[model samples]
Target: MNDFSKTDRLMERGSAFLGSRYAILCGAMSWVSERHLVSAISNAGGFGVIACGAMTPEQLETEIAATQELTDKPFGVNLITMHPQLFDLIEVCDKAGVSHVVLAGGIPPKGSVEAIKGGQNPAKVICFAPTLALAKKLLRSGADALVIEGMEAGGHIGPVSTSVLAQEMLPELSQDHIIFVAGGIGRGNAMAGYLEMGAAGVQLGTRFACAKESIAHENFKKAFFRANARDAVASVQVDARLPVIPVRALKNKGTEEFTQKQREVAGVLDRNEIAMEEAQLQIEHYWAGALRRAVIDGDVENGSLMAGQSVGMVKEEEPAADIIAKLMTQSEDALTRR
Candidate 1:
């Protein structure tokens, strides 16, 4: 049951909505937020989302069963829309009795929503809405909630920052839908600020990536602890013709190679050496499996170290419960101070 320690009405509602002791959400990280991390967060009284990135149906089922064995609390699963086995993944979640399913990466397929909300299993659908138009469309498409993540976040990001989107979307959308603000959130004060502004809750990935429960390699945690906000830079599109998705990450030799790779691809495109689709694929393939190398294999030098601008705020490795308690206390204090 909710302790109701938070005086803020919005925070209470957020906690109630998620059925968690706290309003905080541990945003799923590709290889990092697996069974161990996900269960720890849930058991600590915060909502945890398992990152189903690139996991097949059978694999996802196994992971879900593993997480269930660890924690009896509510948790969710994050699935990329572009997965080849999208429908199969949904079926796995349904049969696993998953309570929540988050669809990310891109716009979902037509019947995907209906399929998720189908049958005896009751899984709430949460989707990323990049624009107001898309947000309305998703709500109409039966998405139970929306998460607006900005450019400051780690991994693939949009062009806008979190603050601006909160200003632009929260006032109109929050009342009608369960809107969660994400990206660049490192502390409870920032979360409190957003909650006051009408965000139902806040989702954080960068800070949680360093939690003691996290399976991310020690090298990955070290890089996060050592880096500042400025060190985390977003990937840019060197060629306007070749559209490459922007990704925020810590600077390293691999990051520099991305620039060179883009330049080479742009040159090839200009000379008609490759088609537009092929050139885009080349740019995208540069970081394929890079996160796994860093998060799982401890290859910080050459692998992808996806971190938000708030990486500077992450100090040391702490238990998942400690992180949740600190953030909750900070939020309560901020509200009282206001």
Candidate 2:
């Protein structure tokens, strides 16, 4: 079935705009979404995004060059907003002629959108809209599209569910912002529902994390296959003064240790053993490099197995092309029945 069919009007428009055979965008994952997975996803029809989680501009340039060597299909690069050298990274993306750029991890910094659009051939900028106000602000800031992701997503997530976000943003801003629903999506029927409601498309991460072309360690892929929705737990806010944001991942030895570390820090803060700032920094340091430890080193028990609740829906490792084809078929069946 043609992805650009008129039956699903908004999805077709999204596919055309993204210059992909399908409208699905593979959500970028740190240490996981590298050259192999990104190229495979792009070549397989879905839009692939490279996660620049902690890459310096120089490293980002090298990775972008490597991905280019693998596939000629259009793909996007995801830049974390908090990266200190953000402007420099944008320069690297522009220099590489990257067609699209996604600004993720909290609201984009001021002038971020302009910096992205200022390139010789402006790249389309997509941002995550955590609230309706942020969605409007991103649009006002010149974002070409918005991804409304919810808490069910893996890694850092907002409080709302994907269904609620679609209800709130898609109906109002889908026409203007090209809204793509993310978080907790595992099946085509669910995606079909969102498109019917008004979403231009959808973004998926956990579904693609275990793709055959993904460079994740076998332990990471095995963990995802063995997990269920309930097993994917979100980090808790242990203390108000500590200022720890929740991170969703599979419950593991590392997770338990994180809890104990937070408790130890909280006790030290109470006794004035460390300043609040230092305590917060201590909490932040707990998970640093943990994702890479699991993804690259195969240390699933002690490293972060960041995966969405949709892990329950993943049963095996498959090629990226097969995954995209199955989703399209499922979506078409649902739409035709409707």
Candidate 3:
């Protein structure tokens, strides 16, 4: 085995926390992060997370089972906080003996953390904190670890940049908590920098979106391959009342369509046809469908092509093991150079 002693030592706490050889995490990309890709990442020694996006409890249960069959290495499940069946999904993960549960999309509802902890398998809870205050609050509220993502991330995102968030939150929270830095990270040099700044580890989505095992459609992978950092853009919220969360994706007809979608959903809100919570859920639901169109059907023009700024760095398809090895080797080299 290649000795990455320096880098491994830096990632010791994170690797121990994740029960993996490396502290790297392949961020959950809906439709893309399923049994094949998730298992491949775990098998490659980096942590992988199943994006349980809009899947029914039964679907999630099946997915968990399928992933387990492929690899015995540890993996995580990402559950959207706003899913009406959030608790039920938690039950599914708990029953399947999932090692970790990532509560994303928003703040986890009351008792959600407790429920995950109280389950038969007692999975660790991970939450996303957009700011320093929320990071501390989530840790205090039983979140075993935290992911602080920036606006550069694909799909749903917060307003801050990753560098800014890392600078502000790492010093204050990393000493007392397991904080994983994410968003716009495309290389191991960047990962090394974050580890040096006290991050427990790092998470990356765009870097692995087109891994050889990824199920994203050929056109979708092509879109990522052709995209430059500037080609990936964030959507604009059309109506203030709708409060639709901003989404980052490759610029395409679908990007413009999302603005129209917000207008249509906002109109429904104006007519008292749907409540605010439901309105937000509708927006979330739209993304799931749109993302599927691109990822599964290869409709790059009208389908959402969610991509982080690091899309520019993803030049070709490679096996998950190779991707992880290259990242680890680069990290080791960077650390050695230091």
lDDT by residue (124-237, candidate 3, tens digit) is 998999988888889889999999998989888999999999999999998888999999999899999999999999999999999999999999999999999999999998
Better of 1 and 2 by lDDT: 2
TM-score per model over all chains: 0.92, 0.93, 0.99
- Candidate number that wins on TM-score, 2 or 3: 3
State which candidate, 1 or 3, has the greater lDDT.
3
- The reply for model 3, stretches above 4 Å from the true place, is none
TM-score of 1: 0.92
Q: lDDT tens string, model 2, 115-197?
A: 88998768999999999998997888799988999999998888898888889888789876688999999988888898998
Clash counts for all predictions: 0, 0, 0
Ranking by lDDT: 3, 2, 1
Query: Candidate 1 residues 1-338, lDDT tens each?
Result: 32335534777777777888766788888899999999999999889999988777999999999999999999999987867688999999999999889999889998898899984697889999888889999999999889999999998899999999999999999887789999999988898889888888889999999999999999999999999999999987887887878889999977877888889989998999988866765554566577888899999988899999999999899999888878877887888777
Taking every candidate in turn, the Cα RMSD to the unseen true structure, in Å, is 2.5, 2.4, 0.7
- What value does the lDDT take at residue 296 in candidate 1? 92
